[model samples]
Target chain A: MSRSTRIMMSVIYWAFVVYVFVPLILMIMMGFKDSKFIGFPIKSWTFDWYLAVFSDTEVLTVFGYSTAIALLSTVVSLFVGTWIAVLLADRKFFGRAVMFGLMVLPALVPGIISAIAFRIYARVLGIEPGMFAIIWSHAVHNVPFVCLVVMARLSTLPKSQREAAQDLGADPLVTFVRITLPYLRPALIGASVFCMLLSFDDFVRSFFLGGYQPTLPVLIFAKLRSGMSPEINAISTVVLILTAFLGIWAERSMRRMKKET
Target chain B: MTSDAPTQGAAAGTAAAAGPRSLWSSLARSQPYQKFVDVLFASQRRSFLILLLPPIIWVLSQHLGPIVQMVSVSFTDAYPRPPGQEAKFTFDNYLLFFREPVYMMPFMRTLIYAVVLTFTTLIIVYPVAYFLARHVKRENRMALLLLLLIPFWVGEIVRTFAIMILLGNTGAVNLILKSLGLIDRPIPFMYTGFSVSVGIIYLTALYMLMPLYSALEKIPASYTEAAADLGAGAWTRFRRVTLPLTYEGIGSGATLVFLISTGYYGTPVLLGGPNTTVFAETIAGFFHVAGDKWPTGAAFACIMFLASLALTGAFLSGMNRLSKGGRK
Candidate 1:
């Protein structure tokens, strides 16, 4: 590239980066503001907001509840998704395309539409709106992601490994448990973390399907509707830090696993 | 009779001699159970069934089931029907959307915004994606991409709140502008179409970037170099070589951004003014009301869903044709 073009590209790239970070930096800064109102010209900075978030029992309870929901939904999605991935990864089967389409349909449907659908469907099934309902919706939504990730990993598995296991007189179940599952460990871990984040971050479904209690995202939305506050900022910053750490770790570990193999 | 008696006698003797421990072991090692296990594992079809059944049931009952229910509900007169009230199937629920311009306005506005913002996001993100994919060192690309991805890890509400803080009346934008002598007063940036668009683009830009970057990254450097050597200018080389190769990426990213923008409820609700309401907020409005209005909401949602899917379908096919034509 020419020098002027190179310079222009650098400028554009940096400008975009600045655009991406400004809001986030502002968010983090607002968390430390002494005032309740969210705006510029910070008169004083304090950790009182963060301290308040840590001390608030309601917030702490919501945090634990959301974590439990994420964990439960992730486990369910991983189990079903890994099963589907294994099934699809096998040599071409009847209705494979149709099944794969059905499997991925949840991911394609808009969040609001699906959230509403789940709400209506839960009523039909006589499933009350609560933790189980939210987890069910989340798991269904997350299955497509888990299945796709696991399938990607499964595609890289060599056929020889399974064949060798079978030749050694291992049953299909044993071969799967001993040979295939181990190979899928990295993908499972990655998908689990991703699913946890997705389920935790989910707001629309949790909002519609929830009864009285709220997920973290729903809580933030409630607080936002009441109006923006430094408390919301502080809570958001805490979530941001956690998810960022988890995301980076998952990425690094996934890359390392790939390298090691 | 003699052979049966001797075997029976031995069984009784062993059972009596060995007591409960031997009896349990013998039962476990019995021929019938062993045969059952052998038969179960002997057939590939059986194993396949075992593996496929759970997912099939889940997809049918959980994934497709709710959508089917929504479709059914959309056709009915009312949902969660009042006591002793029968659900009358009618086309009226869907007719409500066409009959009232109130609903139609936001629906149309949503499609327009989605299309425009998708294109805008493409334009804004394409250069950044290209820069990262081609200009940056390979060793540094992943790190930079991760940095961009951090903001997206937080949920929609948090990110929208970020935008609010940035563009509120006394926000950073106004303060900066004032200090720089750009304006004497705050521009009322919050709760405007401009803010909503900005927020949507910020939220969905990562979706656009990933595909574009991957597409750009896969292009061999030699192709562009060879085009240049053939006396093609920069624009021509890029148009002829790079753009065609990344058409798939562009299609995917555009589709994702468009669909996401159309369905976004939180950002638009948070940032948009009364004049800037999107279809999702309108659809949500129905559910927020009495249960009798749910069917109307369902119908509206179905319309939006079908329209968005159809538009993206057409766009993708057109993109495919364009890329093919470019090759010829």
Candidate 2:
């Protein structure tokens, strides 16, 4: 709290902001660069890279595929993960701790290891790895995030409304449908957006599981491996902007919900 | 049937007495589905079990099942089978991991880098997280945190790619330094442990910051005031009150950073030179580049997984002890 300490703290704070934004700014600038090489001192500006990204059929197809998978996986995770989260929040069963650990275990495990497992599982099941496998992998990986958010929201909910509903002879299902589910709306929205972003941005799992039909990140990684291009920069910038927008929106809504609560 | 009717009538009467137009009462009016709902839910335990069963089964079978499969695969000779030959279970894959210094060195190096990255991120992120928690206005806090997190939402590969652009020989960093007469030569920042660490720290900084910020924010102001009233100096109050309260945050943050850094593949591969091989890249190589070496890959991954599990256990137990000590 000393003057020097205060000055030093503010400097550190701004330094972090600069550290985070500088690279991002460079990336955005690269997207606009006419040259393929990403470097300082822009020689010219062009929208050709952006246009190329849109014109390329493979990139467009992969983008569409990634979007579809992300949406489906998010929806699936929200449905199933909400149930698990609610159960964890509502109950104190004997195996509760174990259940919680198991729920979060997938998220904790390294994605490459999961990818390896998924690859083996696919081979064993005689199921060819494709969009289905990738979607399933993403949904499973994302369940923990949904569960965490929903559980946090559930903990904040007062027990009285739920108890009162049950006290009036409402079944647990009805109480959940009418009372508890509504209470979890903001958390559900926030968590689903988060899960969607995670699934969309996931690379390693998609790389292994996306055998024939690669997701956007898988394609991007593959493209980058070959070498960098302004086109890749364009696609990355688009993805970045989309995710950042969703993230900020989710945070805003969650903050608003917090204030209301 | 007669007893059921009487009970139903009593329930309706009680519901009506409570409030006929209430949300619960409205739901209760759906009498036709009530029996079906009761049969399905029956008990809280039954309902919870029914609800939990699907996701649990999916996670276990689809997610954990693969990991379990990896462990089994590592035990078997998953590659180099002759025509009409059955692969047998053996410890050869794991043995290779320990015997080969190429594998063992990277594993050790990964742990070292993970520790270094965790501590580096902790040191850099702590002050910022503290400032945001203690100084930022309530309305601005969430927005600022969101800004910090926005870069992370861009994906790790993209972020690392950006870092590569920033630190490449002809990158902005070098160009700026050169223009400022800071250096005559472009620093080879792209292919080094320094770059790898910087990239990893940048990618995972928010993970550390958010937890630390929340933990610091949760510290009640009254405790600090009480320390001040006791004639404690700023440094003394911070060391005793602030540090202990936020120690949990540091533990969680460091654990997260370490876990992610150890498992991370892209940063080390893209930015790091030959000397900076990480455990994940090695695993990736085994699976991707080395033909018919998946068993070895599985074994290496299993070793890494076990280490991660141990780290998690230590952190959790330490956390438990910390919470217990705090109570006293």
Candidate 3:
């Protein structure tokens, strides 16, 4: 940690940051550009493209589809993952490590592999490969993630509190509802938000399960493959803004937790 | 979405229970109902089952099920067979895959792509993660990590498009190169192995960096401080103290990047040309786009599956050996 080395590293870090941010800036910039093809150094800025982005029925419908998928998956994960976390935290069992490994396989496995598996599984189950399959596919992925978050939050609360509640004549259900659920509120909210975004932004599984309708990412992918258009840039910019806001909110909430603790 | 340590359910009986489950509260407190009381009071067994089953089924369905089916489908013929002609389940497709020679080049090139991309990403990311975890201000560490995560937040398809825009003939990169007189014309940057590798390294650097950063951050500063106090230089400290501590994380990170990169369809398809497509894209094409030949596509996928499984197994063992060595 010599001063010279530190300065050099800082310079390098800045370069990396610029490399990451520049493209995003360009995307947003192109969204506002009035040009035949997207290029650097904008000439005439206009909202016509952004207007087109919103007005297009296909985009709007896909946007709705994406939102619905995200929302449904998040809700499912919150409830099911909470129960799973509760079960794990409450018991001593054989094969604990193995069970835990299985829990996390979806997160580590590539999306393409999961998508392939889902496609086959849906066919076998006679489930139509459509929006339901897409949402369920996302839920399978999101549950583990949401459970991990909720479980972490649950771990922070002292065991003594819940044990004491039970000892004081509170039933197990009562103890869970009154003592446990309240403490997990923040985590529930955060994990839900995380799940929602994971579903909304996903493209891989959606691509496999897209029967008659496309999700937002699928729409963007199709549009990009067809031809480079500024409208897709507009959509990307919008998604980027939403993601940035989510990131900030998450961090701020985490900081608030640290302060309270 | 990827975490190894999660809180268990034993704690949740105390955590999630609210009021009693039934009207037997008074009876539940009585000595006669002590068994139910003990079960309710001791939230161990039920919690374990509840926490484990759903995700197990979910993952099995999503990860293992298709793979099994894919393996089954690959053994059959590609052409339309009669209703009962698909029974023998031979290894003909796999044998054909080897004998065809069409898949040979792409398969070999994919190996090179994974190795080159893994090395390139590791080379770039190690220093970046090291600096962020060690040298940055405490407040800035999280912000910097957030920056690392931003590109991932934007879907890969969009990022690919962005790369195309930058590297295409009339794109910003070429425009800059032309204006600088660095090149006579815009080289084929958009649909080549070069761009494919670059795009992959960009896409996966974060996954590799996060684990490495976590490992680095967990290493006690005191160890390195002790090294420096003993007159060891920075490079010596990095090699002796920092590197050893991060062996497990490095192994996990490298395995992740390598395995995913091998089966990649997005980067290769978007950035690579007809000559440079990867195995996954070919498999996908045969199934969905080319002619709906699921059997051949499944065959291709099975080859990739086995290859990836072998690679992951080797990585796991190698990492274990390294971790053992580092422990000394």
Q: Where's the lowest-lDDT run of ten residues in candidate 2 chain A?
A: A119-128
Q: What's the TM-score of each model vs. the native?
A: 0.93, 0.90, 0.87
Model 2's interface RMSD: 1.9
Q: A1-261, model 2: which lDDT tens digit per residue? A: 678988889898989999998988888888899887867788999999998988999999988999999999999899878978887897777788988888888787866677777777776677677888888888888888999989988998899999998898777777788899999999999998999989998888888777788888777777877988778789889988999999888888887887787
Residue-by-residue lDDT tens digits, candidate 2, B60-150: 7865788888888888886535569898989999999888888888888888887777888988999999899987888888777877878
Q: List the residue pairs that clash in candidate 1.
A: none
lDDT by residue for model 1 over B176-262, one digit each (tens)?
A: 999999999899999989999999999899999999999999999999999999999989998999999999999999999998888
DockQ of each: 0.62, 0.62, 0.41
Q: How would you encode candidate 1's per-residue C-alpha lDDT over A1-261 as one tens digit per residue?
A: 788988899899989989988998999999999997888999999999999999999999999999999999999999999989998986698899999999999998988898999988998999999999999999999999999988988888999999998898666766787789999999999899999999998888998899899989999988998877899999999998998889888877776676666
Candidate 2 displacement at residue A163 in angstroms: 3.5
Model 3 per-residue lDDT at A236 = 84
Candidate structures ordered by TM-score, highest first: 1, 2, 3
lDDT of 1: 0.90
- As for model 3, its CA RMSD to the true structure in angstroms is 7.4
Q: Weakest 10 consecutive residues, lDDT, candidate 1 chain A? A: A252-261
Chain B: TM-scores of all predictions: 0.88, 0.83, 0.81
Candidate 1 Cα misplacement greater than 4 A, ranges: A258-261, B1-39
Using TM-score as the yardstick, the better of models 1 and 3 is 1
Ranking of models by lDDT: 1, 2, 3
Superposed model 2: Cα runs more than 4 Å off: A167-169, B1-35, B42-48, B79-87, B289-291, B315-328
Error of 3 at B138 (Å): 1.5
